[model samples]
Target chain A: MADTQLEADVTVNAVGSSCPGPLMELVGNAKDVDPGTVIRLQSSNEGTEPDVAEWSEESGNELLDVVDRGDHWDLYVRIDD
Target chain B: MTANRPSVLVLGAGAGGTMTANALRRRLDADVTVIDKGRTHRYQPAYYLIPFDYMELADQERDTRELLHDEVSFVEDEVTGIDPDDRRVEGEADSYEYDVLITAVGNDRRPDAVPGMLEGWNRTDSVYPFYHASAAAALGDAVDEFDGGRFLVTVPDTPIKCGGAPLKLTMLMEEHIRKRGLRDDAELVMTKPGAEVFGTGPKAPYQERIEEIWDERDITFVPEFTVSEVDYEEQVVRSAEGDSLEYDLYAPVPPQYGHEFVVENSPLTDGGEYVSVDDNTLQHETYPEVFALGDNADVPTSRTASAARKQSHVVVDNVERYLDGRSPAPDYDGYTACPILTEEGKAMIAEFDYEDSISAPIVSRLNWFLDVNVIPSLYWNVWMRGYDPVP
Candidate 1:
């Protein structure tokens, strides 16, 4: 269950990051990236699943995939066109 | 398990109340009505971070409505008192009847408990108390303008939400001054009503480590000092024990007491404040149908959110058992944890029960990671949302 096959345009390593940190980073970087770009976010926080999903949908982005990486998680989101 | 759906009424949408209400929702198949004073549910531990600019004030609060399960009925009103004999609770707009009542109306912050504390709180830039978010934000500005002189942090004798907060803020201030290159310009001093820097229990090992930090940093530790009044004009703080200290910048931990509803209405209170409950079961000592937890309950332990976490489990279990026609178990052992942030990146986890048995690695970055990263996220998404693993 790896999202590595998608070849993310930008890899955001938020492994050590906390709650709003991971989500805020994604939102900030999502604005800079071109549309149709896939950004991979890594977060160790347990709230990442629902928080990231809600943020992606609310911001009109597509959550492509979520891969649990044991202690952390890899959430892939694509910028909305 | 009973014939009719049990009616559960809870007061205060805080850690203990929210957790107990949600946990009961999972097992009891009951109609739960929650009475909260406001719509905002605050993440209080984050208050400590606001002054240091580690977190924003807005991020510390959430809609209390969203924290509860959909099945639970929410009431937004001010609670006046509880008529325990009638098994009814008096609220501002309406009254509620309950089969089981849980009062989690935690400690109320009384800045005026000590004379002159609130009078000069925001009026002067040199004096600030960071116990609440509004005050914490004000303290942030004060910390910015304060470049030197004695930075005094004092705690009143009354029970506080988090006993470690005063020390944590003191430590954070020391780090902030040093980081801003004002270390030599400022002298750090911490005065508390208690004789020990930490409490007199399993906190010894951690206290020893803290004392070492204070020694190395040249921070003065004043014990057995109860701040009675603050002379804002002269920037002097007088203690009840007839001692005084001068400071250019002061951060005081305000005295905290139970909600007036618990104190004025029911026989559940002792000393005219603080709900009296069975220390282990968390049930009201006099009224069997009523229960209490969080800072509001007089449990004879350090008043911290961590203690409430453990107490929540016992309350939930005992409440369920009580409904099932069984005696409540004395399960709560006063388990309390404080993830004391030593610095921005490093911290320590102080965990102990009633027996005063200390846990391991008194200080580490691991605990800091849990506090800063994992705990808040879990608290928001899981615990408060009725998804806690316990029970």
Candidate 2:
């Protein structure tokens, strides 16, 4: 997925949050949105990729893509219906 | 006019409460008071170092009253309940009223939460929960007598104050064993409930370095081991998944939780283990006049004195603002730090806030010196006195 082309319904800026912080923020924000809503999570913590991946798989959410932004990462996820 | 002055009541006289009270007393013209059940304030970071005889237990202890500012009143009373609605705190000795309340009562170590753990500590000399001051002292003797065998250190599933303490203790023990020429006979092992040795994210660099260090030193790292029971009779620690590891000596970090009064009696927590506060502002969610910091606050960060020191500045600022009829700002960034002692003389610092890792992941003797030599002095003189120059 092209970074500029894709858009998200919600963007969670957990830039400096480590491990569970970014994942927690993503989950918290995802809960308020409707099912199938695409959310973008920005994080600086390296553990977020695998954690979000595992969480998405376990929770039956769609992990659209993970883009590395030099200093941080932007992970896209779609809430399960 | 005197009655119009706002009164601030702080719960617990530990690092958080003392710093909060002292800072508030210095900043505000309000009546600042600290209530705690314990008489002595212990430097808890030294608990791991105490086992190695690196720090004296007596030196780490101070009278709670002595730590507070002269303007701040110290009440030695066990808190029984908190009525946030009426703004009253009930203690075993007396009841007190406050215009503003700040709960900083730290975690309670519960060894009995795990079956046979308490018995092992009491009946056998093999088990030690080094988180407790007395237990840490006792572990010193145990370490001295241990010549060779499987030396095991376990971390609890609960949220502990210093998350890196068990790792530090494990590494220090490995170094001690190697120096004693017991390296061949001694098998050093550390266990955590999670996959990561320390933690992931901002702690990744430090964790990677720790992994390499452990591999080089022949120290065993066991992950996903949730301590279910400590079998004293068999000298083994069993995990929730039915896996068991036999040990000649054991040092386990016991499960920790909030005080019963705060968790059960007070509506401040809203049926949670910690006080339900706005994580950023450090203010109580429902009560504008209430704030929380330290281990008792439900903030998603590692509980440490460093974190409390940072929170003190925010809490004090917000409390003063609230008294002056101003809205509290979301200034706190969930910053916390852990100085991971890799060996006897070398250490690495993992410092981070909500947004990013602040410290470089490098192990050095200077880090050790700062942690061992400098931080404690600063903790007592500057931090406990609420003379923090760095926010």
Candidate 3:
């Protein structure tokens, strides 16, 4: 069943964060949270939209709330079970 | 009572648009109106890593309203047509006339420009363009499913925002798979249209650095090739040189060209269709009151934000000067900069202009940190605010 419940959430500032840096932040934060946690990451990578979605889905995590703020991004990823 | 500041109009809210808006807001006393079809702004340079599932989409945007000074007028509307004869811009819902117009409407990636691109993009994981937001994310998904095969990255036959981006993706992706213990399982390949990594001038140090990294990594480099079509079914990508590569995951950078709308409508555009403006002054070739900056204009240099920043100053000065009936001689030298990330925590800062290359940093952890850390802060707190200095 799809875990309909979103438990905890946090936001990361990936302003100039590109590539490996943003991924490092995501992986590092995901480790600290319990299962079913959704961390909302905001980035300015104009290229982040499809990238975050693909990553979350590929890793078997739920990705949601992807928005473009012109120069930055807001994305939500649910921690896997 | 009047200091002779020209009433300026700027279109679009991308890097060039914002730079012109902020720079003019600070320099000229004239009323400035910035028109953007959308309210959200995405810092495009940061998108290179989305395919690795490295960054979140939310981190890429900011409110256009927040980035502006209180004096700069922000109008959210899509332009329908430009009436250069009468100095007017027609939008979907409204029309506005201006004494001086700054055309900074950045180009969008028209996937339809290529044959079968949209369908091939939606259908397959073997091919993608990193420059697009969705393509980068899709690339990330493809990488996750990648069990181990040839990983191909191709550059199209055209000018793009950042010339170093494709190479950067190759480096970062290599690092990602290596960390995952799949280095031996996957083969990394680079296909580009340029004869060398960066074909621009002042190229010794940067070229040597890129050549060094090309050899150090197992990444294969195929130069002077253009991707003609995508055979998604067979998972093979064909190039102009008649070479085909079958891949498990393919990331291709699309060829960039001038914005068709302005080029087609305006007689000021060159035959190939880019806004023709003074290289130094950034003023229109025919209309003194009209100016352009960034990717849309026919500036003979690498189309990067760095070039835009320098040009923004000249645009502001000339606008003010044109109104004052004074000569505006603020000349831009076509300087562009991109800190090429050779790898995680290792970057070769390549800063160059139409003539000279400025960034030749000694290899160190500091340079890498600048690309990954410091530049982000600069882009946000400084450059985006119109304070990016000229070197």
Misplaced by over 4 Å in model 3 are A1-81, B1-6, B389-391
Worst 10 residues of 3 chain B by lDDT: B116-125
Candidate 1 Cα outliers beyond 4 Å, as residue runs: A1-81, B1-3
Ranking by lDDT: 2, 1, 3
Clashes per candidate (backbone, < 3 Å): 0, 3, 32
lDDT per model, in order? 0.80, 0.86, 0.73
Cα distance off (Å), candidate 3, residue B223: 1.6
Candidate 2 chain B minimal-lDDT segment of 10 residues: B117-126
DockQ for each of the predicted structures, in order?
0.02, 0.01, 0.05
Write the number of the candidate with greater DockQ, choosing between 1 and 2: 1
- Compose the digit string of candidate 3's lDDT tens values, residues B1-391: 1245556788877888887788788887778889876677777777785665445656777888788778889987767677788888887559888878999886655544556454356444466666766466556666777788888887777767787888888888888888889999988888887688766467567878787777888788888778887777888888778988887877777767665557666565756657889788888888888899988878888888777877877887888788778876948888877778776777777877778878774556787787667776677678778886635
Between 2 and 3, whose TM-score is larger?
Answer: 2
The candidates, ranked best first by DockQ, are: 3, 1, 2
lDDT of 1 at B341: 88
Q: Cα miss at B227, model 3 (Å)?
A: 1.2
The TM-scores that each candidate's chain B achieves against the reference are: 0.96, 0.98, 0.93
